[model samples]
Target chain A: MRQPIAQGRTQKLDSKRHASAQEILDAAATAFSERGYAATSIDDVADVLGCTKGRIYHYFRTKGDLFIGIHLQALEWALEAVGPTAERADLGPEEKLREMVHRHAMHLMNRASYMGPAQYQIEMNLASEGRNKDEQMARILKMRRQFEAYYATVVEEGIAAGAFRGTDANILVKAVLGTINWMHVWFRPGGPQDSTVERERTAAELAEFAVRGVVA
Target chain B: MRQPIAQGRTQKLDSKRHASAQEILDAAATAFSERGYAATSIDDVADVLGCTKGRIYHYFRTKGDLFIGIHLQALEWALEAVGPTAERADLGPEEKLREMVHRHAMHLMNRASYMGPAQYQIEMNLASEGRNKDEQMARILKMRRQFEAYYATVVEEGIAAGAFRGTDANILVKAVLGTINWMHVWFRPGGPQDSTVERERTAAELAEFAVRGVVA
Candidate 1:
């Protein structure tokens, strides 16, 4: 009876399930960030969420799974942030790269507390235990490369058009990424003197600088 | 007889001790970066060094201490690379920053494998245990600031001299740092197609791009 009733509202139920999973990933990211990954346990993640371990287990099969989930979500967020700008046909290469980098900087700061999960993620994927885990890790690396490749392609376009300086697209993209990614080291949103306006301003300046680096 | 003999060889022994400490740090940094810090055991570090855990213990009191040692060394490397340029009174801000960033990129590439310990450190300092540990961590944080401040001061000078764009000195410094420090992510020296000439050329280009982002 309960199964059929739940199945009746499949769309709403699926959305609710998505929300629950997001909540767990956020809690786990915070815990893993505060305590080093090795020191953090699934029980601690449950404690933060004020739920039972079984509840978390229902969503994630293991701690490693939760770690991978957080990384995948970050990649998803990265794609979501850059996809529109990357796809917009009207935008020039410079404008596309600027908007893409600007959005990326903001996204990074929004998840600043999870800088570890966001920035330090790719390296730790192989150390975890689970089946098909290697494939998942490979996907994470693939998405990362693809994320970088978006910037590279735009940069290549800029270089070919003589809008960007003549440099390797790969190196330029890494430098731009380095410039924006460094924000996680200092630009915490709730930190001292941080405000929404301030974050926007910082992101703008970062994008400007990143673009300036590439422009002819 | 032993005490007098040891006293006679003090300076030579001290330099040898320094070399041994450096060897251990390099080995430990490699192990920590390859295996996540949580997954790396001190024994693994010994395995890399081809020595016993006792020898490692003779230098570092614990794994966290070894972690701190690597970070401190990285900071030391950063300072060593930038200090001469930062202090040279003859060079203006433009030259100073260019040379400084160029040197920094090379230094980062040299230790590219320690990107985890170099870039992902400071956050984990608070999670460790020991007497005066907080003081040591604070010093690490302090040295890190002092390093960034080197660039900040230079940028401030450039701003004052009408040489740099009118931006927050702190933000400019961070952007520059992000540009060079990012080499560790993808610029391994011994990796495929890597060469000393290529490293120097990349550093020069990176410095040029970083400085372009700052010039008025």
Candidate 2:
């Protein structure tokens, strides 16, 4: 006799599958960071997650899809981190920029598992063998431009108010954002300067240095 | 029967082989740039050079060797660019640091084919399945430290002389160098801002921005 499947049970199983997919993404990021995106295999990511290759393929059709997924997650978190500051009405342009940078730095250092490899998306784009390379890269680049526009908005406002030195807003954004982005390359968790206090100090230092570069 | 090889002819052949090897390295860098290091193959490099794979193998036993070779070339160029400025006793620390950053930015933008992949050495190390990972990475890191020391020495002297604001010389060095190191990602030779005059202006802008951040 066949038993009817319960709708409630199916929904529970769906949630569980979502959780497993998240785990796969996390494992993939770690493997990509350790083994380089090209060198890392689906089997390796499965091994890290203690799952089968079929399970990974269930969610991601290819390794490039998984890499892009991780990047999207990181970009979402980054935008989320700074979105509130960008929207705050009470803060001046400099304060908004300062808080935005501080939040982004903290988000990068804290969630570096995804953020580290996310910064390497350009490299991933170069190596992607996916059928959808152009479409995927265009989407990612669009998100990146939007992310950059946040800072550009602040810098333009700062210049208008005579708060920051007049410079090419585009170049200035790259210079400061480059400093923050480089954090993933040098700052390591559990390394010599990896304590909570040290991480906070570093975030502060980076924010101060970056903000000072543009202050009038 | 084959005639005995002439001594002068043998030497001339040796030099030609050396020149061919240099061409392979250049071609490899371009391939690595277009296709990330892991995705790039010796066959692709040989294709770019219109030569056979055996020719590349004659100079580089493995892709990792060729990758490291590009890195060494770029590092040598970078050190060469900054070394003269570092040694000029006539210039003050501020002037030396300014000139050093300017030259390095120019080198990065001009020789992006090599410098672009050189900065991606960290990614290469992750992807490298070569047996020489330890030795190659150690050599590269040693050279990187030496390259960084040029900027560090100038920053230290600037701080000591009260010419620049005091900050952690190491962290400050990373911040500014990160800005310059990031040029390869955004600057393109044939892009709208790729004119020689624009390249020079961008270099000056970056150097000015970096040095201004430290001025007391």
Kindly list the per-residue Cα lDDT of model 1 for residues B1-216, writing each as its tens digit: 112111122245567766787788889889877766777788888999899998877766667777777777777778898887899999999999999999988888777655556676557544545555776678777988888888998999999999999887778888998887766656655778789888888898899889999999
| Local accuracy of candidate 2 as per-residue lDDT tens digits, B55-132 | 777666666778777887888889999988988889997788889989999998889899877885465354447554
Residue-level lDDT for B204 in candidate 1: 89
Chain A, candidate 1, TM-score of 0.86
Assess every candidate by TM-score.
Answer: 0.90, 0.90
Instruction: Give the per-residue lDDT of model 1 (tens digit) for A86-130.
Output: 888898888988999999988898876565556764465456444
lDDT, model 1, position B124: 54
Per-residue lDDT of model 2, residues A88-155, tens digit only: 88988878888888899999888888887788546535454755566766777787888888999999
lDDT of 1: 0.78
Interface RMSD of each: 1.8, 2.0
**Weakest lDDT window of 10 consecutive positions for candidate 2 chain A:** A1-10
What is the Å distance of residue A162 in model 2 from its true position? 1.9
Clash count for each candidate, listed in order shown: 0, 0
DockQ of each: 0.54, 0.47
